[model samples]
Target: MKRTRINKYGIVACAILLSLSKVTLAVDNVTPISIPMVANAQVFADFTDDIPAVLNYFTSSTKDEIIDFYNQSFGESIFQEKNESALR
Candidate 1:
């Protein structure tokens, strides 16, 4: 009976190890998204590991120019709001 309990514990440990290895492999296989950046912008911070990456930068370009750059890079139509925000 003691041998049987030891065998069961060993099997359970192996199963846990195998599941953890699979999870590690899945995380390693994740492909990172390519982020488009504005030209000549000074980057403050970048959080690429997040689900949707965050980029903070400062640019001397006008708001319209920045909007045009993003629209061209993303290949999507974007509109500027009266509050000085751009949305796709």
Candidate 2:
């Protein structure tokens, strides 16, 4: 039937377009470094510790506008003012 032919043509055209649309990725010959499992987490903690003061400054600055904030409500502090404070 004419309807069967039209459906076959549509299917063929869709298949051709789908195959042509994909592009193969070409990469350079560079070796990727494998980091330790805890490396990223440790690095993130270090970064968070480094910027505690800046984070506190921003949090304290926005205290009034923000209600029911975890950092202010639960009183759980992150990052110390100094390395000595972190020891205690």
Question: Among these predicted structures, which one has the highest lDDT?
Answer: 1
| lDDT tens per residue, model 2, 5-88 | 367888899998776665322223333443222211323222222223222122332433343354455465665354567457
lDDT of each prediction vs. the true structure?
A: 0.80, 0.40
Error of 2 at 36 (Å): 35
Candidate 2, 87: how far from true, in Å?
75
Tell me the tens digit of each residue's lDDT in model 1 across 2-43. 554368888999999999999999889777666787778998
Worst 10 residues of 2 by lDDT: 49-58
> What would the TM-score be for candidate 1 when compared with the true structure?
0.66
Off by over 4 Å in 2: 1-6, 24-88
Q: How close to the true structure is residue 54 of candidate 2, measured as C-alpha lDDT? A: 20
Best by TM-score: 1
Task: Give candidate 1 misplaced runs (Cα > 4 Å).
Answer: 1-4, 7-10, 78-88
Cα displacement (Å) at residue 4, model 1: 4.6
Reference-based TM-score of each model: 0.66, 0.20
Q: Report the C-alpha displacement of residue 43, candidate 1, in angstroms.
A: 1.5
